[model samples]
Structures are given as C-alpha cells and as structure tokens.
Target: MFITLATLTDVPELTALINASYRGESSKKGWTTEAHLIDGQRIDNEGLAEQMEDPNAVILKSMDDAGKITGCVYLQMRGDKLYLGMLTVSPLLQANGLGRLLLQAAEDYARSIDYHTITMTVISTRTELLSWYERRGYQKTGDVIPLIITEKFGILKQPVEMFRLEKTV
Candidate 1:
C-alpha cells in the first residue's frame, strides 16, 4: 500500500470512491454507509477540484498493489489544528487496517506542520463511527453544529447535527 497526496487528475476517481464509501448502494457493503441518512452524490468533480486547489488543504490517498486508490482522507489546516474529514475506505477494504494507516499518516502530517490538534466532525447519527474514533483517542467536544446543506451535499431527510471530535497531537 502507498499513501500520497491526491492530485487533480485523481479527483474523479476519488469522488466516486468517496460516494461509494459513504452513501449509495455500493456503500451498503460497509458499516460506514450513510445511505439511510442522505441521498445524492457525495461530491462532484468541481467541488473536488476546488478542494485540490485549496492551498491549506490536501486529500491523502492510499493505493493498492495494483496502483488503484483504495482509501483516502481529506485534511485541512485550521490554525493550530488540522481538520480531518471525508475519510473513505473502499467498502471492500474496510476494517482491514487501511483506515488506521491513513489516520496515522494524518497525524504525521499534523506533526510535520506543527499543528497540535486534529479535529473532525461526525454526523450525530453515526454512533459506530464515532465509537471507532473514540477508541483511537478522539473525544467529543460536545459542540454540535448544524449541518451544512448545499446543492451537491445531498438532501437531508431529517435535521442533522454535526458532533465535533478533537484529539491533541
């Protein structure tokens, strides 16, 4: 496995992998699916390109033996903290340690940049995912933020709140 910064040329595949890992029928193969909570494309090429262009942000991708991206996480610098989000592992590869490896890479990136904290927001309804993070040393900050809804973000069938989690690096 190899982990590297995602380039613009990888956006389309990254977008599809993200959607399949988080929402849609393909996501159902993994325990991380949000298909029951929202319905729509997880991200579009335009949005992904914007993220790739953000100077303070980066998307780290994990490649398989065949050189195919199989897992990834989005990281952004937020002052002293690195905001981690959109962590995706191919449904077929979930629970096989790739997620943890990506997370370790994220922490390494944080330390390299001198950031002392890492923060991420999880959907309140995703208890299992939150638990997994807790096991990894993240603690809930008890800060609930209203979900941000945009045209491409997907439809919220019910009100969704984001629970903030933080870890001091």
Candidate 2:
C-alpha cells in the first residue's frame, strides 16, 4: 500500500469509503461503525470538496496495489497544531492494521509541516476508540462538548457528547 495527497478526482470514492466505514449496515462490519449513534450519510462529495478548498487542509489517501483508495484521513493546520479528523479504513479491511498505518501517516505529515501537536474530538461514548487513541499517546483534555446535530452528518438517535484529545507529535 502507498499513501499520498488526494486530488479532486478522488472525492467520489473517498465519500463512499468514508460513509461505508462510519455509517449504515456496511459500517457494522467494522468496529468503528457509528451506525448505532447516528443515521444517514457520514459525508458527501460536496462536503469533501468544501473541505479540500481550505488552503490549510489536506486529505491523505491510502491506496492498495490496484490504486484503489483503502483508507483516508483529514488534517488541517489549526494555528500551532494540526486538527485531525475523518480517519477511515475500509470496513472489510479493518483489523488489518490499515488504521494504524494511516494514523502514522498523519503524524508524519504533521511533523513534516513543523506542527508539534495533533488534536481531535471523539464521541464520549466510544470507549474502545478512546482507548485506541490513548494507547497511541493521545490524552484527554477533560473538556467535553455537546455534539452539534446537523442534517449533513445525520440525525442523532440520542444526545451525544464529544471530548477533546491531543497528542504532542
């Protein structure tokens, strides 16, 4: 597998990959599924386009030998730190260490750009995911915030909260 900066042509596949990894029945095949927490598309082509428009942001994509995008992560320069989000791996391919590879790529990208820290938010109820980050050196800041319910993201089945986690890369 190889990792590289995503281009406009990658938007459609990225969108499908992200949604399949995070929402709906397909997502249930992976441990990262948020289908029980919310419903609807996780992200769309338009959203990916708008995010890519940010001059300070980039979406890194991982591809297999056939050049199919297998995983991706979004990173944006946020002042002195890098904000990381949308870390995704193909649902059927999870547990194959693709997530870890993408995560390491994110840190490498941050360091290359001279960023010292990386930050992200995780749903408070995702204990397993929080543990996964903690094992990789992320620390909770103890600041929990309510999740912003938006139609684009999906309708929350119940009230959800997110907590900040950061790591000095």
Candidate 3:
C-alpha cells in the first residue's frame, strides 16, 4: 500500500467511498456509520471538487496493491494550523489501522509544512470517535458549533453539535 495526493479523477470514486463509509446501509458494516444521525449522501462530487479547488487544501489517498483507493483524508492549511477532515477508510477495512495511518499522514503533512498544530471537529455525540481522537492527543477546545443543515450536508435526524479538537504536532 502507498499514499499519494488525489487528483480530479479521484472525485467519483472518492465520493462514493466517503458516502458508503459514513452513510446509507453500506456504512452499517463499519463502526463509523453516521446513517442513524443523518439520512443523505455524506459528500458529493461537486463538493469534493470545490474543496480541491482550494490552493491551500489537499486530499491524500491511500492505495492498495491493486491501486484501489482504500482510504483518504482531507487536510488544509488554516492560518498557523492544519485542519484535518473527512478521514475515511473502507467500511470493511476499518480497525485494521488504515484510519490511524491516514491520521499519521495528516500529522506528517502538517509538520512538513511547518505547522505546529493540527485541528479537527467531531460530532459532540460521537463519544467513541471523540475518545479515539482524544486518545491520539486531541483535546477539546470547548468550541461548540451547530450542525449546518443544508442539502449538501444532509438532514439531521436530530439536532447535533460539533466541537473543535486540536493537538500540537
């Protein structure tokens, strides 16, 4: 397996992979599924394209031996810190360490760019996931943000809040 920068051609597959890993019935196979909390596509091609257009952002893809994208993470330079988001792994492949590897890749990228910290947000109710990040050294910054309800972000089954987490890399 290897990691590399994602290009425009990766949007379709990446979008499907992300959606499947986070929502719908397909996501039920993994522990990361947010299907119960939201009921629409997690991300679309256009959204991915828009994020890719940002000069300060990059999406890293993890490819298997056969060259299939098995995992991915979106990282962006935000002021003096690197913002990490959309970290994903194939549902069937979760817990096999791919997520951890992708996170490490994000941290490595941050350091390479001379950034001293990495930040991300997590759904406040996702206790397990929040604990995972906390175990990895991320701390709650006590900044709670309301979930943005929109066609692009999907309809929330219930009101949800997100909190910022940061770590000094």
Candidate 4:
C-alpha cells in the first residue's frame, strides 16, 4: 500500500468510505465500528469538502496496490500542535495495517512541520481504540470534553464524551 496527500477531488469517495466505515452494519466488518454508538452519518460530503479545501489541513489517503483508498487520516496544524481527526479505514479492509500507516504518516507530517505534539479525540467509551493509541505512545492526558452538539454530528440517544489523547512527536 501507498499513502498520498488527498485533495478536494477525493472528498466524495472519502465521505462515502467514512460513512460506511462508521455508521451502519457495513462497519461491523471492521474493528473501528461506531455503528452501535452513533445512529447517523459519520461525516457529510460538504464538511469533508471544506476540510480538503482548507489551506492548513490535509487528509492523507492510503491506497492498495490497485489504487483503492483503504484508509485516511485528517490532519491540521493548530498552533504548536497537530490536530488529527477522521482516521478512517475501509470497514472491509481494517486490521491490515492501513491505520498504522496513516498514523505514522500523520506523525511524520507533524515532525516535518515541527509540531511538538499530535492531539486527537476519541469517543470516551472506545476502550479498544484508546488502548490502541496508548500502545502507540499517546497518553490519556486526563482530559474529557462533551462531544460537540451539532445536528450534523448526530442525534444523541445517549450522552457522549470525547477524551483527549496526545503524543509528543
């Protein structure tokens, strides 16, 4: 597999990949499924397009030998830190090391830009995901915040919190 910087042109497929990876039964094919927690779309096309258009943000896409996008990581420079988001791996292709590759790319990008740390938020209840990050050198940081309340995020049937995780790069 190879990783490349994504452009606005990749938004449509990225959006579809993200939604399918997190919002429904299709997500169950992967270990990163959030289908049980969130009932709506993970992210919409417009929002993804905006992220791609942002001058300071870049989404790194992972593709297989045949050039299919299998995973992606959204990254942005915020002050002295790199903010990471939407780390999505194709549901059917999860656990094939795509996620780890994308994460290493994020760290390399952060180091290239001289960021002191990389920070991200994970659903507070995602123990496995959190542990995965922890094993990769991220620390809990003991910080938790309520997830943003926005219609586009989802309709909450239960309260949710996001835990902050940081890794010094």
Candidate 5:
C-alpha cells in the first residue's frame, strides 16, 4: 500500500468513500456507521476541495497496488497540535488493520512536521470508536463539545455530543 497527499482531483472518490464508510446501508457493513443517527452525505465535493486547499491541512490517502483508494484521513495543524478528522476506510475493508496503519502514518507525518501532539473529537455515543482510539494511546481531555451538525455532511436525527481526545506524539 502507498500513502499520499490528496489533490482536488480526488474529491469525488474521497467524498464517496467517506459517505459509504460512515452513513447509509453501505456503512452498516462496517462498525463505523452513523446511519442510525444521521442521514445524508458525510461530506461534499466543495467542502473537500476547501480542505485540500488549506495550507495547513492535508488529506492522506491509502492506495492499494492497483491504485485504488482503500482508506484516508484528514489532518490539519492547529497551533502546536495536529487535528485529525474524516478518517475513512472502505466499509467492506474495515477491521483489517488498515485503519490502524493509516493512523500510525498520521502520527508519523505529524512528528515529521514538528508537531508534538495530535488531537481529535469522537462522537460521544461512539463508544466503540472511542475505545479503539484509547487503545492506541489517545486519552479523553474531558472537554466536551456539541457535535457539529451541518448540511455539508449530514442531518442528525438526535442531539449529538463529542469529546476531545489527545495524544502526545
């Protein structure tokens, strides 16, 4: 597998992959689906393009031998820390350690860029997901915030909350 920075040309595939892995029936194939609580696309092309254009942001893509994007993660430098988001792996490809590989790569990338900390927010109800991150050495910062709900991603069926998690890289 190979990891590379995503370009604007990747928006379509990236957008589709994200929605497939996080919402709708396709997302149910994996443990990461938010379909039970939200409905709609996880992200749009315009939003993804904007993320790619940010000088402090990067979307790392994991490609297979045949050049298919199997997984990806979004990272942005926020002050001294790297804020990670939008981690997605093909729903059918989850639980195969690809997510872990991508996560390690994110940490390595952050260190190479001189960042000492990595932080991210996980939905408060996503206990399984939070456990996964905790096992990887991330800890809750006790900072809770409203989960961002927007048409740019999807519509929430219920109130949502998030907890910030951090790890010193």
Candidate 6:
C-alpha cells in the first residue's frame, strides 16, 4: 500500500468513498456513520475539487497495489497549525488499522511542513471517535461550537455541536 497526495482529478472516486463512508446505509457497516443524524449529502464532487485546488490544502490518498483508493485524509495549513478533516476509509476496511495509518500520515505530513500543531473538530455526539483521537494524543480544548453553516454541508437532524481537539506536533 502507498499514500500519495490527491489532486482534483481524483474527485469522483474520493466523493464516492467519502459519501459511502459517512452517509447512507453503507456507512452503517462501519462505526463512523452520521446517517441517522443527517439527511443530505456529506460532500459533493465540486467541494472536493475546490479543496484539492486550494494552495494550502492537501488530500492524502491511500491505495493498494492495484491503485484503488482505500483511505484518505484532508489537511490544510491555517496559520501555524494544520487543520485536518474529511478522514475516510472504506467502511469494509475499517478496524484493520487503516484509520490509524492515515492519521499517522497526517501527523507526519504536518511535521514535514513545519507545522507546530494539528487541530480538528469532531462531532460532540461521537464519543467513540473522540476517544479514538484522544488515544492518539489529541487533547480536548473544551471549545464546543455550533455547526451553523448548512449550505456546503446540509441541515442537521439534531442541533450539532463540534468539539475542537488539538495536539502539538
């Protein structure tokens, strides 16, 4: 397996991967689903493409020997820190440590870019996810914020809260 930077051209597969990993019934096969909490698409192709074109953004794609994308993590530098998000692995491929691998890659990437810290926000309701990040050395900063913007993403079934987690690299 190998991990490489994804370009805008990879949007189609990336979109399918992300949507399958987070939305709809397919996501239920894994522990990362938000299907019961949200009704609209997690991310569209255009948004993925736009992010790939951003100068400070990077989408790391993990692939097997056949070159199919199995996992991906989105990272962007904001000031002195690296903002990470959109981490997705094929639902069927979860629990095999792929997520950990991708996360480690993100940290290494941050270090390579001379970033002093890494930050990410997780949905407050996702205790499993929060615990996973905490185990990986991220600390909760007690910064809970409302997820108010709904255009890029969609409306939430319940009022959503995000917890900011940070780690010094």
The ten-residue window of minimal lDDT in model 4 covers 148-157
- Regions of candidate 1 where Cα sits further than 4 Å from its true position: none
Predicted structure 5, TM vs. truth: 0.98
Give a tens-digit lDDT track for model 3, residues 1-169. Answer: 8889999999999999999999999999999989999999999999998999899999999999998999999999989989999999999999999999999989988889899899899999999999999999999999999888696778899998999999999
Put down candidate 1 lDDT per residue, 17-115, tens digits, no spaces: 999998889999998888898889788899989988999999999999998999999999987789999999999999999999999999898998899
lDDT of each: 0.92, 0.96, 0.94, 0.88, 0.93, 0.91
Candidate 1, residue 25: how far the Cα is off, in Å: 0.5
Task: Judge candidate 2 at residue 70 and give its lDDT.
Answer: 97
Worst 10 residues of 3 by lDDT: 146-155
Query: Which model scores highest in TM-score?
Result: 2
Error of 6 at 41 (Å): 0.9
- Write one digit per residue (lDDT tens) for candidate 2, span 54-130: 99999999999999999999999999989999999999999899999999999999999999999999999999999
What TM-score does candidate 6 reach? 0.97
Ranking by lDDT: 2, 3, 5, 1, 6, 4
**Best candidate, lDDT-wise?**
2
Off by over 4 Å in 2: none
Measured with C-alpha atoms, the lDDT of residue 81 in candidate 5 is 92
TM-score of each: 0.98, 0.98, 0.98, 0.96, 0.98, 0.97
Model 4: per-residue Cα lDDT over 45-162, one tens digit each: 8988888888889999998898878889999988878999999999888887888889999999898888879999999999999999999999988999987657796666688899
Clashing pairs in 3: none
Candidate 5 lDDT at 49 equals 91
- Candidate 5: residue 24 lDDT (0-100): 91
Off by over 4 Å in 3: none
Supply the TM-score for candidate 2.
0.98
